[model samples]
Target: MATHKRAETLMDSVCEDMEEKPEPYFSFGIIADIQYADIDNGYNFMKTRMRYYRNSLTLLKEAVQEWDSESTKPKFILQLGDIIDGFNVPQKTSDTSLAIILAEMEKLKIPFHHIWGNHEFYNFKRKYLMESKLNSKPLEDEIGQLTINEDTSETRSDQESFYGYHFSPYPGFRFLLIDCYDLSVIGRDTMSIKYGMSLKLLKEKNPNEDLNSPRGLEEEQFVQFNGGVSGAQLNWINSVLASSDEQDEKVVVIGHLPIHLDSTDAICLAWNYKEILSALQSHPCVIGYFAGHDHDGGYSVDASGIHHITFKGVIETPPENQAFGTMYMYEDKMVLKGRGLVLSKTLHYRNGRKEEPVH
Candidate 1:
């Protein structure tokens, strides 16, 4: 009996050691659509509940504090856009609201990347915003060492901001940040070439003279508010993905607009989502696509086995409630650990593999 008990104890010890082995290559913090402002709570255009514009500031602060306390801190934080809301009195209050949010993010003392969204453009022009908020800066620490392959050959019509960029954090992985609003009306002047193109495109598709209205558009995606990836940007994405594939690296594509119908409202999708999907399908190395804009959030696995994850909007959370997440990337899977309203999900690589849940 004593000999048998000793053997069982030894077996248990080995199993525990195996279970404790670390698998995640790295992790990062993700939050979306904080949409912070000093205005009073109000309903969305469709009467959907939008609560506590000021409270989002507190929510962001909590997220920053929580990330700061983690033992294995995130390599960086990705703010999925809309730092301020469209209703924030434009230039008068927009800059102040943005400053408040930026101050909170700065408390994290880590590299944080950003993208543009419709609401951002409502507050500032592309040139001003690029010069102020989206200016390219080196990330801090080892995370900053991840180099971006900038395509210098392609130039914007008016030296406008190019929000798309790629970074390789480690040997086997790359992150692609796409500017989904490349052809949107909000950021460009009436006389700008891109703005004219957007107007013409909307006029052709949407019969509603109020371009923002979807009443007369047959397809939900035909709304003027959503934008598409430009030809130049699409080429850049193709080049990046192709190069990454050659390096045997997997990619995670991040954007402010949803690229998949399963992961967002039909109306909130990018105008050229189908084309984007086709591009993604051709790239076997893309493991996941993360996005924000559909407030409620969702997840779906495409036929190509790429995971589409839409983060819950912080603005939609009720007063005192919170929404955010941290993503852990591993050899064969990625785990999104949710906080507050966000739902946790484990996305495996191709072949339908499974792994231990992220706690």
Candidate 2:
């Protein structure tokens, strides 16, 4: 009886110590859906409220200034896509609009990682977007390329741009950025294999003549605006996770589309979220999933204790309001300090066996 009581007392003391303070390993800045345009303010399809398309540039500048002024300074900035608005000016002027936004990001003087969203596809082809805009070098150079499977000798050559990339700012920590539009209708030629596959899926899953409409679709995620992970991409992700697991490294996945159903609107989820989640479940290295698509934003922890955070869009913020955040990563938890319209959250880390999916 005495030994059991002492053990309980020791456990309680350890638990109390763990709750005392947070110790971050590293940190980074995160912003989503800047959607900057040179056009006047306009309303969305529903006309609920006006979208401050032009004002988003000011917001981006402010966010960069804030991030640059941080005492510890974030290692890098992660832009969650839609940097340039789809409705920006004439089609011929869209590229220039994109260049303006890119120039703003360059002022920070820190490495900026970008994920491609649907709206970006509205302006350029995947090859041009990836090779010329996003990537630091041409695709042929294939800098930092990873082998998907050692047994099959398959290399990830085509994905040099936005397909997927992993980075480690510190030992025992990794960030995986996924391109959710790999299999989407946007950015791919109609005659391409991926476009054909996307079309077939749309035909079988969505019966509406307007594929973008969610009216008759049983699954909210079947809409055309959303995209899925390709089989090759999935294999690459699994390989990376497996490698991370072997190294005992913790991972934070950043995608333009939400991977968890409850983390955002159903229509904003990735089409192959289930498959992606299943892949993530098999590897206990993933600690958090961050994304931006549904402007309202959401947060939820799965049964495995992995956090799913959908960042609010900067485009939706009215004048004087803002949306952006910085994530401080620690060994046992992550702290998100939100500014403007974004909400702060504390997510505890859990590294263990997989559990049932969170609704």
Which candidate has the top score in lDDT?
Answer: 2
- lDDT for each candidate structure: 0.80, 0.81
Tens-digit lDDT track for model 2 on 28-91?
Answer: 9999998888888888755786788889999999999999898888888888988888786464
- Deviation in angstroms for 325 in model 2? 0.4
Note the residue pairs that clash in candidate 1: none
What is candidate 1's CA lDDT for residue 84?
88
Model 1, backbone clash pairs (residues 3+ apart or across chains), number:
0
Q: Where does the lowest 10-residue lDDT sum fall in candidate 1?
A: 350-359
Predicted structure with the largest TM-score when compared to the true one: 1
Compute the lDDT of residue 264 as modeled in candidate 2: 91
TM-score of 1: 0.90
On a 0 to 100 scale, what is the lDDT of residue 227 in model 1? 85
lDDT of 2 at 168: 80
